[model samples]
Target: MRITTVETFVLSERQLLVRLGTDEGLAGWGDATLEHRPGTVAAAIRELSGYLIGEDPLPVTAHWQRLTRGGFYRGGPVLGSAVAGLDQALWDLRGKWFRAPIHQLLGGPCRDRVRLYTHAGGPPGQTAAPERARAVVESGYTLVKASIAGPVGFLDSAATIARFVEDLEALRQAIGAGADFGIDLHGRVSVRHARRLADAAAHTRPAFFEEPLRPEHSRLIGQLAASTSVPIATGERLFCREEFVPVLEGGVAIVQPDPAHAGGITEVFRIATLAESYDAQLAPHCPLGPVALAACVQLDLAVPNFYAQEHVIDLSSAGSSDLAILRDPETLVARSGYLDRPTGPGLGIEVDEDAVRAAHRPDLLVPAGNPSWNYPDGGFAEW
Candidate 1:
């Protein structure tokens, strides 16, 4: 079938979804949410659609190369994310045409079910982190990741370090030895503080420390990894295989690539294999929407190196707007901390067009970038 039209939708300012329609009437859906810049991503997708319209949609790899390399200036968040969303839609369309799941097209399933880990967001200072951590454990998840709280100084006081240790201690006590906990520093801490933070968490035995330092500081993370036994994990901000090379050499035990932002299934699969070569685990970063999560799950099932997936199981409970644009939401529902492989063709989830259209609010104004944080002296800090 030939591509007829390419369209984009926004449930809010937070998500960009793409739909590809072919002459044969088959429709494929993809999500290209780029944090707070959904409009920019949508515009990028529309610009790239010029190359896709009226072309045969089956040559996914060829199309991916054309979309990415066709532009003289390519491969930033907006362009990469635009290509990623279209790539997912094309793959979804191809899977449906072949009458098989996307993973089967890759090489069939390597695992029976895909394991998942949910986020447990807590109050500032992480004072109530343990309570939230226990709730996820009680809900049948053996693994959960929590964010570091509030603003952190470049050289925080001993009390600051102690408070973080205390929070981790509380979570360890609340969940007992049966569960594993991961910490997302959000790349807000300096190397000195990050080293101290990782050293202090030795007693807690965290599953991994995510983005302890920003992507630019990946080289120093290996030193942090060597200084402490805590497994270092990063790469959510990185968009391609080239960006991941230094991170892998940095001795990170896990690599977190967002399929929606990192060129979709095609690139993330290559990233997974690259990490595997370094003996690193694949724990995809996916805190966006359902279609992005579904795409990650499809990749997770097809690869042997996949360790776990990052997901926000209940959007409303997470204090986020409800963006359940799926006709069969149950297709993505995880049970006992594991998501059974999707059997339907394509990405294996159906989008509720009416619901998405109703939620679309292009006029909504969301300030770009995360909220800025600062120390008492008003110096810049990472959020």
Candidate 2:
């Protein structure tokens, strides 16, 4: 079937959806949302649609190569996100045409159910960290993660390090030893702070220390990995396999590539395979909408090295906005901390077009950008 139209909708300030319609009437959906840059990604999608208008939608890989490499300057988060949405749409079309799920098209399932992890322990300095951890564990999540919230200085005092360690220990104790807890530095800490925090939290044994150092300081990941026993996990910021090479070689135990911003299913699956060769695991980073989570679930089922899945929304919650946009809210809900294999075609979840369109707000098409912060001395601080 030839491509007929490529449409993008800014469903919310944080969610962007893409729908690719074909002459044969089969349409595929994808999420290309780039936090704080929805407008830029939407424009990128429109620009890339020029090459896809009359092309066949079944040749997913070929289309991916051209959409990504066709441009002289390629592979940043915006371009990767644009191509990622289109790639997901192409794969969805291929799946529908072949009458199979995307995972089956990728050589079938590796596991019966995909394990998922959710964020807990609200912003740092909250006294309810343990309570939040207990709440998620009681809800049937065996794994949970929380970020080192708020601004962090380059050389913060011992009190800063102690608070993080105390928080992690509390989460670990709250969940009991049977469950696992992870800490996300969110690229907000320097190498020195990361080292100190890792050393102090080693007793708690976090599932992984995510993005301890920013992407720019990735070369030092191996050195950092050598210093701590904790597993080093990163890659929500790194866009492609080329960018992942150093981290993989640096002994990063888990690679968390976001399908939405890391070339969708096509590239994330490849990234999982690349990580597999290095004896690492794939725990895809997905903190966006339902379509993006569905896309990540497909990869989790297909890749043998799949470790766990990260999600911002509580899939089991009935009132979550993430589920409101779907035709079947239960499509991605986890049972016993795992999502059963989806039997439906494509990404396996149906997007409620009416809900999506209704949720679209023109004013929200352009995000106001992420929050910024400053140190006590007035120096800029990472948010």
Candidate 3:
């Protein structure tokens, strides 16, 4: 079927959804969210649509290549995310055309179920981190992930390091030895601090330490990895396979490519295969809406080295209404921390177009930027 129109909807300050309509009366949905930069990503999608409109949607890979490389100035967050959303829509259309799930089109399932992990933790320095971890584990999640909480200075005092270790230790104790948990440094720590923290918390045996250092310091990851016992996982910021080469060579045990940011299913599948060659596991970084999670689940089912899936849990007492954008929200939920392989066509979960439209907030069409933080001395801090 020929693509007739490419439309983008800014559902909220944090959600950007794309819809691809075809001449054959079929439509596919994808998430093109780039966090606080929804407006920018939406503009990118609009620009890329010039290549997709009136083109055959079945040639998913060829389309991905052109949409990605057609612009000589290619391969940044905006272009990758724009291409990612369209790529997912293309795959979704292909699955519907063939009457199969996206995973089946990618060579069928490698496993029957996909294990999932969710984020948990209170604000920085709160004693509630362990409690949150325990609650999720008690809810039947065998895996949980938490951030270090609060901004960490470049070379903080010994008390800072001790508190970081203590928080992780409390989480480990709360979850017991049966369950596993990951630590997300959020690229807030320096290489020296990452090494120090990894060494101190090695006894807790975290499932992995995620983004301990920023993307720019990826070349130094191997030195940190070699000095510590915890498995290093990154790539939430790196947007392509080429960006991931040094991370794999640096001995990162897990590759956490975000399907929404790293070129969607087509490119993430290729990233998974590349990581497989390095004997690394795939745990896609998905913190966006349902379509993104659905796309990640499809990739998780087909990749042989798939380890786990990172799903976001709104820690607010009010919870999240993000799932209202989906017709069947349960389709994306996990039972006992494991998601059942979906039988539905395309990305598996169906989009509620009316809900998506109703949830669109016009104010979000203008960027407000993410919250910024500063250190005690008034210097800038990563948030």
How close is every model to the real structure, measured as TM-score?
Answer: 0.96, 0.97, 0.96
Candidate 3 lDDT score at position 132: 78
Q: Write the per-residue lDDT of candidate 3 for residues 311-335, one digit (tens) a residue.
A: 7744222224656677777776667
Candidate 3: where is the Cα deviation over 4 Å?
A: 313-320
Question: Candidate 1, residues 1-383: lDDT per residue as tens digits?
Answer: 99999988876555688999999989888888888888788889889999999999999999999998898887878888898899999999999899899999999999989878888777877833778788888888899889988688877888988988888898889888999999898988888988888877788899988898977787787788788889989989989999899889979999998888899889999999999999998999987888888899899999999999888747323222343678777777767777888899999887777887787777643535678888788888788
The TM-score measured for candidate 3 stands at 0.96
Candidate 2: tens digits of C-alpha lDDT, residues 242-319? 999999999999999988999989999999999999999999999888899899989999999999998887687556
Q: List CA RMSD, all candidates.
A: 2.1, 1.3, 2.1
**Stretches of model 1 off by over 4 angstroms after superposition:** 315-323, 365-369
Better of 1 and 2 by TM-score: 2
lDDT of 3 at 167: 84
Task: Count residue pairs with overlapping backbones in model 1.
Answer: 0
